[model samples]
Target: MSGHSKWHNIQAKKGKIDAKRGKIFTKLGKEIAVAVKTGGANPDGNSKLRDCIAKAKAANMPMDTITKAIKKGSGDMEGVTYEEIMYEGYGPAGVAMLVNVLTDNRNRSASDVRCLFDRNGGNLGANGCVSWMFQRKGQIVIQRQDGMDEDELMMKVLELGAEDFAAEEEVFVITTSQEDFSSVREALEKENFEFESAELTMIPDNTVSLSMEDAERVQKLVDKIEDNDDVQNVWHNAEFPEDFEE
Candidate 1:
């Protein structure tokens, strides 16, 4: 696994959960609404909605909140229309960064995002600038359990159409082509596999090795961006030292 992945796993394990839960729910709600608006309110008939519901459930979002979001998105209730946007940039040490956001006000989101980058020793760039340094793919993570057989799990994921699989110290990561993501996830779900995370993400082609200082700076930038209401996800290419303190 890359340093970015390791850092992500560590964050998942140790980040402040209670303080961030509300923000997480807000983001998931937006995703659910967008998914319903684009596809439909039915998860069975709408893969995007299905994925959103899965994500919401993983976050432990209440069923009523999920239902309300779907209703609002399907025009059964009042809600603001949101537009999806992607911002590309370079963080400290020339680390390529990608920000994904869904917002009702594009100008506000753009300004907020640009300000975050600027204040954090980075700058937002043109759309294709840093995007070219990354590839779109589906990533799924499952925690490593005591009773699990690594080889058997790898075979299962491969059989279900995953492109690659890696067994990290604390988790199993599976990669799939963007088009294959939903099917692969569905297959895994049918077999009763639980996930730490399952999402379509931007994977960097290569990473920039950063010193401790640079890594801290880049991570702070990432945290600020992620804390924004409209920002749903942030992808970066910085590779910190394995033993670097969080």
Candidate 2:
């Protein structure tokens, strides 16, 4: 499997825990709120909000909670207003890291993120330090089902403008240019396809392989950063050894 596919598979396994599920909902709520604030409340008119809603539903977030987040962002209800921020850093083995956060207090988030890196044998860097090593792409993941035809799926995705496709052990990963993400996703949805996850992501151009010990340290650092309520996504270029335990 590709490094990205392996990382995502590990994450999927970890997300089965109840505590992680709650954290996932909280993060999705923040995303919905921010999407509503940036692009109006109506999904038909706001592509970002529509995508957030779809993600929220996929995560099984309660309808009422989703509605409340929308209301909060649309000014119908009072709530914390979050600002998006990006933090760049390097983890163990010189692995480049990018953290995306939605924070009401930038200073607190920055301090927390930096401390995680420092304590985990990494260092936070100035803006643009590691970003140049990655490219923005739209990624969609669908769980592979019994008797699923890979050829058919590839053809379907290519016709819908997807840039690439990979059939991993448990899921099919599809990549698309950012501009074609929405249309491709809509087309797939119309065909009644269920997705494991779908979102715009930063993909590393190259990866840094790490020893088992260093890989563990980097994974811990990533977990700590992701557990922070303000953090939305954590991207990295660390490639664990093929035989490394999850």
Candidate 3:
């Protein structure tokens, strides 16, 4: 992962961001809607919906709000239809970026995203530009401790159908196929393996390195992309040390 990506993961640990609450809720709502529309509302039958609900709960979303969103998505209640979109781009230092969005108006969102990229030292690209650098995967991160053995954990998760496991500083990162995500997670839970995170994420196949100055610039581009109201998630191929400061 790039330094910018690591920064995003670090930011997630910094506590609630009330200033961005509205934006966050919008994104989360879209996720719920999509999950419901795609897989139905029952978490038991729809693992994707279940994961989305879990995330919304973690964000402290109201129960009624979640239910309403699901209803809208299922067409039991009327609401605007959301379209999922992806934008590919290159940032300063030639870092590849993939931005996932949920929008009711693609033209408006696209224009806004393109503008944000231009303003932040990056430029949006054609569909396949940066997408080839990434693959969708189920990712989970377990908090590290003094005595945890990477090899042991790797063996356990791999046996449960995980594709890869990496120990980075105090974090154990596990990757799995999209279809196997829920199964692998359930297996881990059955074994009582505690994880700090469990989510569907895009993993980069390769990373682009840059000087600190260029990396900071790239981070700014990422921030701009993320700050957009229509953006749901942003993935990038940039690598930096886990302990890199700033």
Candidate 4:
């Protein structure tokens, strides 16, 4: 049991991002397109593309948009290339942070990210500086509902290759080794298990406890970083208050 629940952090993000629906969909489109570019157009054979599709759906993006995004990746956007980059850094109170970026203009993206970090009381770090503090894992969150059997679900998840399980106040968090993530997720989907969230994410090895002020500062930095079109995901290890808001 990792006993760590980033579900609240996710919820807090969702709460604030509702107003950015169009931008969110556009970013998801880029993600789907990139996934298709690298892993083929078929989600069944490409876990990364499948994951991108899932994220698009979760955001309520229309199916046609997803199909178009997939097509965009299938060579329609010739001469345009996208590169994935990982930026590492530290936030307020020494909290480690990682940013995942996908962009055609690497130089511009880097400059923009650095500026955001500088403005938010944070600074970019060397490649290996903070990345060593995180482990890539498959994380799935299933919202708690009446009649769900926790033990039974845990057993099933384990049988499907999950590495860890934690029951939080309103959700069950399931984690799997990087290699086992796709199989476990596919199995759950076959069994009709709906997920609140599912993705391959960098899980912090440990967290930094921050005062409320520092937490808010770190969160503000996170928001600013995420607002960038090139940034795909942001991972951090900072203990924060419940119900973080704008």
- Clashes found in each candidate (C-alpha, N, C closer than 3 A): 0, 0, 2, 0
**TM per model?**
0.91, 0.91, 0.83, 0.95
Ranking by TM-score: 4, 1, 2, 3
lDDT string for model 1 (119-198, tens) is 99999999899998888888777878789998898888888898888778778888898899999998988888887778
lDDT of candidate 4 over 44-75, digit per residue (tens): 78989988877676567899999999999998
Ranked by lDDT, top first: 4, 2, 1, 3
For model 2, state the Cα shift of residue 104 in Å.
Answer: 1.2
Model 2 spans with C-alpha error above 4 angstroms: 1-4, 7-19, 76-79
For model 2, where is the 10-residue window of minimal lDDT?
Answer: 1-10
What candidate 1 gets wrong by more than 4 Å, as runs, is: 1-4, 7-19, 76-79
Evaluated at residue 134, the lDDT of candidate 3 is 84
Candidate 3, residue 158: lDDT:
89
Candidate 3: regions farther than 4 A off: 1-22, 57-77, 145-149, 241-246
lDDT of each: 0.82, 0.83, 0.76, 0.86
TM-score, candidate number 3: 0.83
lDDT string for model 3 (129-217, tens) is 88887888887766787777778888988888988777666677778888998888878777776666677878788778777788679
Best by TM-score: 4
